[model samples]
Target: MRSLAGLAALVAAASVFLYLLSTHLPPGPTRGPPGSAEEEEVEEDGGVQEYRLKFPSDLDELRELAEMLKFYNREHHGYVLLLFCSAYLYKQSFAIPGSSFLNMLAGAIFGPWEGLALACLLTTVGSTFCFLLSSAFGKQHVVQRFPEKVALLQRKVEENRSSLFFFLLFLRFFPMTPNWFLNITCPVLNIPMPIFFSSVFIGLIPYNFICVRTGSMLSEISSLDDIFSWGTLAQLLAIALMALLPGALIKRYGEAHLKVDGVDSNGPSRAEVKPVRERW
Candidate 1:
């Protein structure tokens, strides 16, 4: 019952927040002239369908929103920025999907450089909120649900403590693992906040630029695949490899120095250098 009440409260709060946000925005386009093709389709589906607003999960819906915002770009710039930032933050805080659409929308509305900056800033901020929120509310649940994975991650983090920042950079750059999982696990693994923030801010630059640039060319993109061609993927792979290089070098040099000093690379050496007592 407590859980149910909490869930209800969360939903209510989100609804109120969204309602407030919507009220501040410029009105959407008026319904297509009555009895036009859009209305005809609505009538064919029954009037009930026309009144309901579905969640913006469909690409068509996102594209439509982008189109609508384009009309108000010059007139209501502040409101648009506020709305975009708020919505993006909310999405990230809850680990919601569809950020790809938002990234594209940023490019479409702000152009590439500005869009890239916005995407990175909003992502870092939102992800910070997510990290803190997960630390408070979801950490135990995640640990309970995936003990083995958590343990493995903990071990890996411990093993790479010296180069953890670079390891994090690699994770952010490549994103082979989901961001939400990383947000949750990083807190649980006790990674420092500064390191997490720095790594996320810097490591996301290349990928964010790619995503934003794709948005700048929104008109040319017919599918997501079009944005991530083989050439693009290869470039991204190269960037990820580059990000990993520093950590790899650090580890390699540290191992070499340890070997030269007659120390075990994996552990302390058994041999000890002791001062010999002088014969008096």
Candidate 2:
């Protein structure tokens, strides 16, 4: 209950901060700063119009929002970046969904290369923040809420303990399991921070790249279907399969010759698995 309360309080605080930031921002596409040449150009094009600054639910809304931000980015560039980062981190830290829209938005505003870089960086940092928050405040609540899931993942982690990093990579690349669940449950699995961080940063590059690249052509995208079509899914599955190969090789090699504390060299000795279970 204390863990639940702590998580609730932190989430509420983050929500309020984002709310305040959103409300304070200028609401529409406007000219550059006063007396600037861009201001005249913007005025000649037409005065800024109101647009809702909210999470877009569809492609059309995403395009509108992206255009609005791009227009705002002209004059309040720093604020635009801060707003994007803050919102991205907020969703990530809280395990909220809908970041695909934001990734595309970054591409639309920052262009392809910059957007991909920003998306990858933010995905890593934001996910790490989520991991830390889960470790700090949500561990107990997560275990209680999803006992079976917790047990299953714990078992899988133990099974892949020798090649945990590749297993983590496989999970990220595959997307069979939702990323939020991993972020929240990893601490409970006792995965090391460095491994978790590295896996997330590296594992998500392809996913982030696709989103940002699609965002670069946001104007042409008619629907989310275009983003996650059969081809893309197949490609991701291929990458996920490749990720598993290293872990498979590692496990096979370990079983064939590995020894634990001078124990049997055939398979994972009882000695190897005992300590991990004891820790849990």
Instruction: Point to the candidate with the largest lDDT.
Output: 2
Q: What TM-score, over all chains together, does every model reach?
A: 0.67, 0.74
Q: Write the per-residue lDDT of candidate 1 for residues 84-203, one digit (tens) a residue.
A: 787888787777877788888888778877899999998888888878876666666666665555555565566668778876776675565567677777888888899998888887
Per-residue error for 187 in candidate 1, Å, reads 1.0
Clashing pairs in 1: none
Worst-scoring 10-residue span by lDDT in model 1: 258-267
Candidates' C-alpha lDDT: 0.66, 0.75
Clashes of each: 0, 0
What TM-score number comes out for model 1? 0.67
